[model samples]
Target: MKQATAKVSHRLRGAQGGMEGRFRLVLVVVMAGVTLFVLGRGLFEAPDAPDTFVNGTSTSPGGHRALLHLLDEEGFTVTSSVDRLDVLNENDFQDPEAALALLEPSPQFLDKYESEVRGLFSRSWRPPLILVLPKRHYHALQSDEDGTLVLQEGIYSIDDSERVLQLAGLGSELGVRRVTGGDVIEPDSPYATRIHDESDEAQVLEFTSAASPWRKLITDSRNRTLAAVNPLTRVVVLAEPDLISNRFLDQGDSAALARHVFEASQCRHLVVDEALHGMATRASLEYLAVRPPALWALLSVLLLLALFAWREATVLRTQPAEVDARRSREFVIEGVARLMLRAKDFRMAAQHLQQRAPLALLPSRAHVHAAGVAGSTSASLPGEVAERLHQLPENDGSEEHLIRVARRVAEIRREVSLSHHVPSARKPG
Candidate 1:
């Protein structure tokens, strides 16, 4: 008995072990496939979107497309908000690890959207806001063959930036420092600090508010603020846009600086606000919800659920039951016939029978053409059933009316079926 029990237990254990191993393998394979797909998308995704000055999604020479890609490689999930500032109040953005980047805002943008821009810092519950001040002053040289504005540009001087700052309502405290000769910034430090490759003429911009008492997050040798943050509000101001712009992204420590900005902001999720860049967008979860792998997975789940519901939603009709008013008999009526003659079901059925009557009485090819002519055609319920139908009651659902209609249908069906079998010369009555 002990030997038999042991053998049975051993077999059961082996079966369970095999099942567990198979399940684990399936899980790992699924996870690996997802990881590869996500990485592949990040690696091969489109570089940019259409927009104006300092677009984070635009790959133009003045855009931050490269930096966005770099941020993705560094494990940051970047999205562009073209529609709304729904993120400001969204629960996901409420996390401390989320940041909103307002790319180089020209003076015109600030003039138009200063309230909306300032709202980012004013909100009680918000993500870290990084405001990158404009570096290039744009002047259209000429329109290209594509009607695109070709700009002749030079860096915005400290005094030149005052117009934008004043328009942004950020006060004129910040300045852009231009140093002809400088040193290589140490990699040991954060990206938000000091000007890198200044000897190469790196543009450095600073933002500070005496009222906010923000500590310098990015600065140079003279401690001119390149970026700074308010300890209380968690707002980050990156004065220079060059550090992450497409033109300078690959030059020196800019890529590293971009990564450090993410780390220093304490945010892994970042949104590049493009609504102010003239890209019409609204705040919506659809942009994030449809992100790859998740979309496919959602569709698969929906399909599975649909199949399961189809299989499990079996609705067995109740067996029909009715008895004659005065008889020693119990007759089982069909479910539909037994239903009360209400306006809904029976009225529709009566109309259907009326429409089918002429087809039943006429030869198949007789009812084909318009203007009293005829042609040959055949179809299921919807097509060429009849040129005309027997008139049906508009509202009456009385038992007598139902019986009369039923008897007429039965006669028509009998005549048609018999006519088909009898002879080609025989006509349906």
Candidate 2:
């Protein structure tokens, strides 16, 4: 009974351990899944709000929404101000009577849209256009019809024969006279007369001091006010950009002024907030238009390689190498001869010759007298004996004549030693 109880306890413990291991595995899997999910969200999600627009430009999320609301209220279809040109071109907005484009002065306005501007003017079916120029540098604004117009101060009127009338002036004076001072009538102005009203809706317009030279247009005499609605081509140019900034859309009566402008304009007006136009995309396209000389570059590299191969094949050759082998043998013989001549030692030369010619019969010192060879004598040996010594054959066993010549060399040494009367050692000692 005790053994049965013990067996049951062991089984229970094993089961418990198995359950705990399974739970840990599940926990690990859940944690891994959570980590991967977080990483994927970070990688694939849109960047934070700050990175949504270019630096130094306002994203104006509220202002953009407010503008859309104003447009809708005025019975006009509203679209995002982002990449306005692409939207216009994609929709084939070349019907002049159908729509007008409202543009603000920003980096995008000054740079990327230059070609689009030219195209718009040149096209017979182009839409009416409006551009906001800074009041301080208003002199820089040029009219394609009449060259350039320079404005120093105060309000100036332009009379272009085209259907669109372009107006550039201080927004503050326009706002003060029209909205705040209850002078809602500009009867002489072509389009302003159509939109003016003395109702509470018209009084809802706000104003602020000019924050910049561009802002001076949005101020009263105190240099503070909302932007003025001066028409360009059924299009209106507002001097101060901050009225449309994300921060100020909800402040004071700015939203009302924005609404009034949209209601007054044509239903299909192309509202181009220059801040949202993508200069990077236009610049990238321009860069792609100018192609690199890749084909020419590749041809040049291939030609260089071919020339290199041709030069190596033609200018260099591998001969039979007889010259190298002959050179090697001559070098060895001359080197050995030089060493023997420099040392002036016949014994050392004989030893070297013996090592080179293994089959040669080498004479012992005792054979010096019998070989008729002089030994360390001041007396000169005959030139014939010296010549005979040099002529001694390099011993190969096939030549009997060489063996006889070796015996003759020994006799010559002996005769020279006797004639010189020099005692010679029996061996080279």
Best-matching candidate per lDDT: 1
Q: TM-score for every candidate vs. truth?
A: 0.46, 0.30
Give the per-residue lDDT digits (tens) of candidate 1, residues 316-354: 434222122222233334343366333346556666667
Q: What's the residue-level lDDT of 224 in candidate 1?
A: 50
Error of 2 at 11 (Å): 83
Residues 1-429, candidate 2: write the lDDT tens digits. Answer: 856866676677678767865775666556556545544554455432322221224233312445555556766654433444434544534433344534333332434455554455445544544333221112223445767443322221111101011222233323322232232222223211112224511212233343432221233322333344434424344433334444455555555555544444454645444432343233332233222454355446456655654664467444333333545878889988898567665544454443443223333445566756756343233445555656665544333544455466667757654664534446665
Q: What is the model-wide C-alpha lDDT for candidate 1?
A: 0.60
Superposed Cα RMSD, model 2: 25.1
Question: How well does model 2 score by local distance difference test?
Answer: 0.42
Looking at candidate 2, the ten consecutive residues that score lowest on lDDT are 156-165
After superposition, the stretches of candidate 2 with alpha carbons farther than 4 Å from their true spots are 1-65, 81-105, 118-125, 130-232, 268-276, 279-429
